[model samples]
Target: MSANGLVQIEGLTPPGNAHRKTSKVMLLFPPEWVPTAPYLALPSLTAVLRQAGHEVVQKDINIEMYDLFFSDTFLFWISGRLDLQRRLLEERERRAALTDQETDQLALLREKCTVEVFDLAERAAEAKRIVRSQDFYDADKLEWALNIFREVMQYISAAYYPASLVFYPMESNLGYRPGVSREVFACLEDEQVNVYRDVCRQLVLPVVNREQPHVVGVSIGTQMQLLAGLTFCKMIKQAFPHIHVTVGGNVVTRLQEEWPTHPQFFNEIFDTAILYEGEHALLWLLEALAGGRPISSVPNLMYRGTVGVETNKEIYTEKTTALPLPDFDGLPLDQYFVPERILPYLATRGCYWGRCTFCDHGQGYFDQYRGVPAHQVIEQVLALRDKYHCRHFLFSDESYPPALFKKVSQLLVERNAGIKWTTLIRFEETLQDQELWYLAAKSGCCTLYYGMESANERVLNLMDKHAKKSVMRTNLMQASQAGIWNHVMAFYGFPGETRDEAEDTRRFILEHQPYIHSVELFYFVAYRHTPIVRSPEKFGITIHKQPEYDLPLDYYYTLNEPGGLSCLEAMEMAEQFYQQDFHPWAVRVNAREHVFLYISKFGTNRLPQIYAKPEDRLRGTDSVSGLVTWPVALGEGDGNKEDGPTMTRVVSHASGG
Candidate 1:
């Protein structure tokens, strides 16, 4: 304790003392940069490069440009464009209108439009301040910020393609749908209304020019990031033709798997494209690039050759323990829309249950099952917590393994990691055990996103989720009762799924509203290399020739038995279920996991009443509550000490925890 009863808190400092280093490189997560947390790929890559004695810089343009986007300056440009268009429309209508009613309506329209534009501008300014300020986690203030984004996006969506401030990588003709390279170039050529293109010019170019990095690596994880990533590469290559550009991530790996089938578009955009785990491959590539060795020697990479695309076989590493700790040294971690920063840690690589028919997660990122030992994960978690002054963490794994997760949970209870965390989990026998769920909560497990693809057992089997409806429902309640935020990711429109089966999903949610905190439901799309597409006849569907898209697409057409909910029907059902009924609290699922964590920490939950203090919680089978067993000596005081393993700091509950 301080002699004066005042706590001394050290500020966050970057790891490297050197202001800048030669052999410079820059890694970026392109727009729309998620404002929730820093992307995991860049930091992991940064750590590897820094360990290799290369000075690597990291940037999340998603966040940087977002600060710029939500200002009066951006709004001013948008509002001016909106006003000009609307006034021109009004003039066109007035030229033909002579009636008093028409005149009144047009006059009223002008009045309303003026009021709305000014109101929208004010809202944008207000949101910019709150988000850029310290009070970002306040739901009310956050809502205002959201409103500003939504309004600005609405205008942009009208002028450009339909854009969104909600889900990231907002819909563009350039992204999501599959096409060849020429189409991609056409979209990039459009400078007037390409939102992501503008992001590249304004935000990315200047930074690249200043740094003049030797290599510029861009991370494209989701289908959404496809266009922006491609655009990012194009801009870098055009601006600094000498700078080597590499594109990689889950999305890149998947696209590379289908390389032979697709036209030769990738070679034009990036110097090299990395597939699957790029750790060893990238390290070798960088070494070779710097050493003037044969670039063809780099495995897991497709490089442009003098004659054709030169492909290399990827070297696989089953043991994940050898990788360096992910470094978040260069990001503005505090600026994410949360009171406390949420650090993303990868405890494992790939899924243990690699049998899911609908999922391609196992195809590359989680190709073979591997995980760091539980003790090591906890050790790293503790180290990261201490270093960053962050207690909340998000595990960026395909699904945390049952055995590993349980072991970590128990260790967390013992060590009191003093950390709240969330992860994607498959509903299995291990999780069904209520005791393990309780242990998870005590270890500070705040949210678990279960892939409840369907509540209908038949559809579940068809999708190869392999989870029984009854069992999953029971496990959900147990986890919920244990005081963990049990969120779900559900989907409809599997090959043989009927509307009735899809409705059963809704029935499950309604039946377990108390236990289930949130859900993300949608129609399932067939990605290339998924089981259903690989063996369409096995699922009683005919694979149709799909149109080539500018961006590599995840979905293709299927001539299936007409019993399932069509994609459009599924969208309608989601609108009815989430928007009409659930509204603000129960909303559409975005990539933001921090929102769930914020809700758990800052918002209300039933845990405090249900969970007993550690002491009262029984060590064995007794009438009590704890993670697994409430130790007899563990009272509120002891429980408090055991639960908070990290350094102590003063926390104010004035915001209503």
Candidate 2:
């Protein structure tokens, strides 16, 4: 039976003799998946397999590609190309001729060549210097490191693909939408423009084919990874032909829900696609595959069947707290693009307040909120600390549960678990407690990112964000005062939101600039099946020309009213906001440099006097090393003149840099 008929059982095809159980599995995180650290899925899955006693190997191809692409050897090769082009251009001019197009091209190259050549050489020099320098992680040197990295990546991209090839937050120009299926397919087969494909061919396929793992898993955690993820999967399937391939992550989970129409497109790339909390689901499927058993027993999976395509019962009720700690064993800890190793750990799963209208917490992507016990979480932390000598951690949760965080902080106090971390947090009433704020800071919560989608009360209500603008303001202030770096996330273009809300948000950021160290502004993209999309009328909006999708893609949105802030307008506002110096503390919404920035400044739970002047702000410095001295104010160090936290400059022989 096809899409029109009753589902039959014939389509199910198990891996043939070519995919015989080798008991070895390889998990890959493709290029542009992430820049700084590896996404959590690969490690989580790898850890599960390792615990289950399966031979597993995992590698972050993004970081490997980063190392190779940014090497001096690569830069020299590019320099050679530029030099050859110069010679060829002169020789051609002397040899009597140039076509109009060739003349235009030569002129453009000549105009840009000197600057490009010099810039590339300078970027190379800076990179070589910073990588070898002792103060590599210092703010200034790190910025130098990032600049050179950006240049090298740009060089690669301009030469082939037009992708940004960023690391801090994975970004790319490759198509990720449902309509781009054919484009993605072409990209996979194209060797000329597909840089990510080239990356997989050089770094991915060889290692994968060498290991010849029976199962290959790819994690498409974000839209940024979608295209490359699909491309990588295509390469694997084409090369091996019989290796079982599966994909899971937020993107896959959401797509499976909205377009349950088992996109045979997905079938072409993946044998099975796992959704939701995948620990048990993935493990069960692997167990079945290895044992040569029928896969119907596995839950939360979609597999193509002979009769038709089908999905198994969802992994709806797994208690995440009961799951084992995520293992980061097989990852390359040293090669990440960051100066300090920032490992990811999740204390909880899903958003506690699942009512945000634009958010899809209810959509199978998010779990019904739950948290692991503080002690169990700490045990894992200690183990990871031992295994990977890194103190920085990023809590990869939708919203870091305030209660769980406080509990974890108290435990960190009782037992000295010295790890500094940052995470996305909700600004709710619970944060009114000053003690909670203090405890969070003392427990090494370096930054708390607040989702202040809008600062206008009406916009907040419209989005069903639950928290008010006042609450957001107060929470930010308290968090900042508590010695935590408050990072704000703002998005405009909520259906009913207009200039009023946009200005209100801008005003709030300006008013509380000291409290906010960064702002991640986004122009809202209405996704399918979310509350906004399900009932556009409720928000007085009319979605126009919405095409029925065989695969999941979020578009088909229009404002009911005339000439309002469309996505483009909102984008313009965000660009203006970023370009202008709207506040005293530099609002960095572009890169993940703030992680190292904060580490280089505040080493512990100490109060550095908040500087009101932008000039006093520190960017990169070598002096921060000495600031890692004794405890700031130990326990109950709130406001006592003697024992309380006191403001002081880093007070070191910090150079101007």
Candidate 3:
């Protein structure tokens, strides 16, 4: 509405028959998710919808967007686009002295225009080939291939000037605050920086026109995906008014309370939002849309009622045992950015030990815990393996329980499923048995990611982790001895953790460097749904609320008495740790998937070839301070892992898929 004549998206419901029968459904996984593998949400929801006799076409636009970024056609198109921008910027400059922002934009456009598109495109294609072939095992080739992706991403980012787009970690910023609803609406229609608008026009709308589906569902799993996912929804609603657009995912569930306040979201963006555990909820919502049942009867749904937007009172949780196996029929499984097909199979919903005070992962679930039996899990894993012709699996469970872990390991050994897999688990006192680690390794368990949040017992108790140092050390030693790659996740700050306690964690990782294969360190964030935020006094912190961030899932805060490390100190300590203490964990391969493949191929965690060269390590030591810092790529080490079954939500565990 500001410069372009796009209508202000408010109070304008598309002319769709909301209660029309829905038969065919097109589900979309939007951009900014890790492109290494297909997110489990689409397949999970597709299985449920198809089981109900509905025609479903699941599309992973995230991977498609990445795949498009490195293509000759797209790169050439980008070059032309940059040239056009250059001409327009020059025209503006001729009229008057260019503003600072405009000058910078023009410079970026000019720089991008000079790139040899043909050469770049050829190298880009080769890079993709290297990653998907036997050449992927060569460490140098793989590193070059990954760097090529980052280079392409840089070029693409320049084309969309002012928006900082990135390839890995899915941390692309569109220069808009997604937590601010008004900015979100503006970002949806902005043609200048909103690359997603172009993405939708080129990739999404054409499919909608061809498929002519009755419903289009977009899964938004993380805060990083919010802008892109909502852009798809609003665009789909605008282009095909007859197709009801819906959204569901971990992010949606987290923002459920914030959504109803903005009724325009329901009126213009999406017709409905299905909250936590969407398998059965989505199926029933489709039935309601088809007029087979009352709209009010649909559970875990937020819809536009006569009064305004209304959330259904009922909550529905799927019975893990009765659900159909995830259907990956419509997904482009081979197109993932990996040499081998890695399928994510979730055996559990929600964390079994759901006691982390600073974690809000439990809020994404209607039920605290629900897991399929060990035999059932084995059957499903084997079934998925055979059906997909895949030997690698990611058990995307939230903190795999000790009992289930042991039983599954034993079963995998018994059946000799011959599948290499990994998952997230705790340092359980019950799992200290050496035989368990041996059995797990024999069953093709290549790596295990642990949430070793702290090394000091006091801090652990405060975080409700309750993990003992002795138990953690024993587990790591046993896992390493059994040839399992051990990746530990720790944070710098809890509410009252002092510098000494944070040092205890750093010292622990340093002392146990041989046992720990990788480490991900992060500063703490007080999420909106965590117990600390609900009762700030209990954690001795003051929550600072910003009026502009209407849809915030996390908050800024200050310690009440300032005895412990302040937030700024926490940030500095984390940075210092990464800069000074990064040498031991800073390997040539940083991505968890890449590390896992190495472990599986080499049959040991002692991967000397993956380490940085001696010169590189020495260079790190000679940096601005004590050592050189390695550029870490966050594949599965983001430190904010989500529960597996919450529809494509990713967590910080080392299981990338």
Winner by TM-score:
3
Q: Point out the higher-scoring one by TM-score: 1 or 3.
A: 3
Worst window of 10 by summed lDDT in candidate 1: 633-642
Listing every candidate in turn, what is its Cα RMSD in Å to the true structure after a full C-alpha superposition? 13.1, 9.7, 7.2
* Model 2: per-residue Cα lDDT at residue 613: 26
In candidate 1 the C-alpha lDDT for residue 524 amounts to 62
Summarize candidate 3's per-residue lDDT along 1-657 as a digit string, tens digits.
Answer: 324332222211123534435489999988877667777888888997887678998999988998888899999999888899899889999998789999999998888888988999999999999878878889888768877887888898898889988755456788998889999989998998999898898889999999999889998887777889999999999998889999998889988999989998998999999988787777777777777777887778899999999988777766778889999997888888788888888888777777788877766676547788999999999999999999888777768889988999999999989999988888989988999899999999998888887899999899887889999999999999999988887777888999999999999999999999877776777788888899999999999999999999789999998679888887788778877777766666545666778888889999888766667776764311112342222222111233221111123422211
Clashes of each: 10, 9, 8
Q: Give the poorly placed runs of model 2, Cα more than 4 Å off.
A: 1-22, 76-134, 161-169, 174-179, 257-268, 314-317, 361-367, 545-552, 561-568, 581-590, 593-597, 604-657
Give TM per candidate. 0.79, 0.80, 0.92
TM-score of 2: 0.80
lDDT of 2 by residue, 18-130 (tens): 44343688887765544566567777776666666678888787677777676666656655654565567678888867767556546644544555655676666566456
For each candidate, the alpha-carbon lDDT, in order, equals: 0.62, 0.61, 0.80
lDDT of model 3 at position 203: 87
Which model is ahead, 1 or 3, in terms of lDDT? 3
- Identify the runs in model 3 with alpha carbons over 4 angstroms from their true place: 1-22, 620-657
Which regions of candidate 1 are displaced past 4 Å?
A: 1-22, 76-122, 129-137, 155-180, 257-268, 550-552, 556-594, 600-657
